[model samples]
Target: MIPTRIAVIQGDPRARVDLAVGALAPRLISRDAARAHIALAAAGMILLGGDDVHVDVSVGAGCLLEIEDVGGTIAYRADGRRSSWTMEVHVAEGATLLWRGLPFVATDGADVERRTTLHLATGATAVIRETLVLGRHGESGGRLASSFVAGDADGPLLVEQLDLDGLAPEPGVLGAHRVLDSVIALGFEPETTRGDLVLEHSGAIARHLGAETHTSRLDRVWDEWVKRARQRTASHVDKPANEAAVGGN
Candidate 1:
């Protein structure tokens, strides 16, 4: 599978970012000394049949990166064919990453597997937003296997996996709901305490489930968590200056 790569590092004049095109095109939308914004646009039709896609991203120490998705993706049915998508992310010490992703819909007769993993160093921060739709309008959806794994320098933060098939609808799995929206913040505490699960490590995940995507209540959670995540980035950014001042004295 051809892979898409994006990386950012601290530089003298500004932060330098690198990008390579594969299934998705990574375009630099905006940048400053503190953070760089990149938009991921689909290069062509995706996840039709027997397709595999991979994305790799890295944020260097003392730098930040923000990613935006241009559009959502829908998996079209391909006569019992299977597809897969995987993403890997790494954040160095004193770095931050923010990603806002669109919906990933699995249509009827489609089969797809997706996995995402995150690795964080000491004092690293990350906030992620994801929306998973089971099917299109009035459709029973297809087979989906989704996994999320995250860890820090000390230990693992979160590990979750779900297997949903359109043929079965039960009480424990989705339970008549078609949408699952989640907002995750790592290396910081969320200001909102209610209706969210705090991880054993340093992080929180706020999730919402509903029949429809428009009525989902995760927008407020996303805003609050993003605010808290940005606060942590500020402290990481200022540490080097403070250390230099101490060394001079």
Candidate 2:
């Protein structure tokens, strides 16, 4: 397990960071009075059989955190075994989380479980981009079971599960598609919803399932969604009630 934590108070000039690195290394790329940019790099071979990777993220009130992946992740063959990856995120009121993820490829014979859990306070927002690729050059991919859950103090916002184990090519599933790309915005809907499915709650997800990564053509949507999220976070005005009392801290 690789533990990474960062926070910024209402009037703080810098972000406080804590870390205990394992298979992944987290580094602060840049920071300021209102925002922080960080990056995650792979330390060594990962997603092998019996490997369990966990990530925990927290954004303080009135702060903004942006995370970028240095490269992509490739899950190799797991010889009748399995690997797991989990991420848990908490966004405080008036804060925002933006995660820019690269592609994740599962090679032949690979079996992996991926899970994400998100918690958003009132008025908080988050934007995420992810691309899942089935196989490498010329082979059929392995099995992947992915689950996601997101909610706030009021109630549940989103919940979904995708099981590709022996069901990748099913009618409702991938079905001859090797790539599944998505750009998701939570806590608020973006400016556009063209050809995208709107969530039941105050959120939306733009997805593209195609034969190849480039064929998805979701980069433009990602750019627009990210811009919208940035604008919202930049102008958010709410802060904790005690912010005035602890402004000097």
Candidate 3:
């Protein structure tokens, strides 16, 4: 059994969840009242051969949503067929969404395809983090193709595709590496002394292609972006109250 899809939409002041779940689908573990969002926990044995999963998320104007996964996701050995995972996200003007994704591991004989698309309106913000690991401890992994596209109301901000196979020697791509970790930040740009790939649009992307231990290369950038995002959200949340107080005075 595999989970087909999970959708989350922002209501007046909270987020609503709709699940199309199977026996092996991830379950909602906890909800944060202050954040007005919920967390998801993966269930027993997930993502076997021919498994397909989709997640859709929308944040209404002026709202905030946060999503996190409990642990890493493993793709078991697939004889021939492949497993697919897709995620689509939409953020309205003045809204924000933060997603903390766990690592994805592909064991030997596994084939997987992962895609992510994000659309943001003017004044909206989004932060997404992802890590892909080819194999487990000492073994070489299988094949994985990952695609990501993010844009705002005006036009596309970033478009990228990464193809990786443990059987192939990629001197130009990974070059003796097994991990690809990245973070995408939209509607906010931070200055960094280190090298970071700056997109054509307003946001920026930080990526590291090396061993799993080097995944922390983007930690500083991620931390700065998250801090700024939280501050922005706090100010937005207090605006209405501040206005009301001024009116009363």
Q: What is the C-alpha lDDT profile of model 1 across 64-168, one tens digit per residue?
A: 788989998888795878999899999999888989988999899889999999999998889999888888999989888999999997888989999987768
Badly placed stretches (over 4 Å) of model 1 are: 235-249
lDDT of 2 at 128: 90
**54 Cα displacement, candidate 2 (Å):** 0.3
What lDDT does candidate 2 reach at residue 193? 59
**68-145 per-residue lDDT for model 2 (tens digits):** 899899888989889988888999998889898999888888999989999999889999988888888787888888
- By lDDT rank, best first, the candidates go 1, 2, 3
Error of 1 at 178 (Å): 0.5
Model 2 is weakest, by summed lDDT over 10 consecutive residues, at 240-249
lDDT of 3 by residue, 131-180 (tens): 88898888699888899998887888888898988888477988898888
TM-score against truth, every candidate = 0.92, 0.89, 0.83
- Better candidate by lDDT, 2 or 3: 2
Model 1 error, position 225 (Å): 1.1
Best by TM-score: 1
C-alpha lDDT of residue 211 in model 2: 79
Model 3 poorest 10 in a row by lDDT: 240-249
Indicate which candidate wins on lDDT.
1
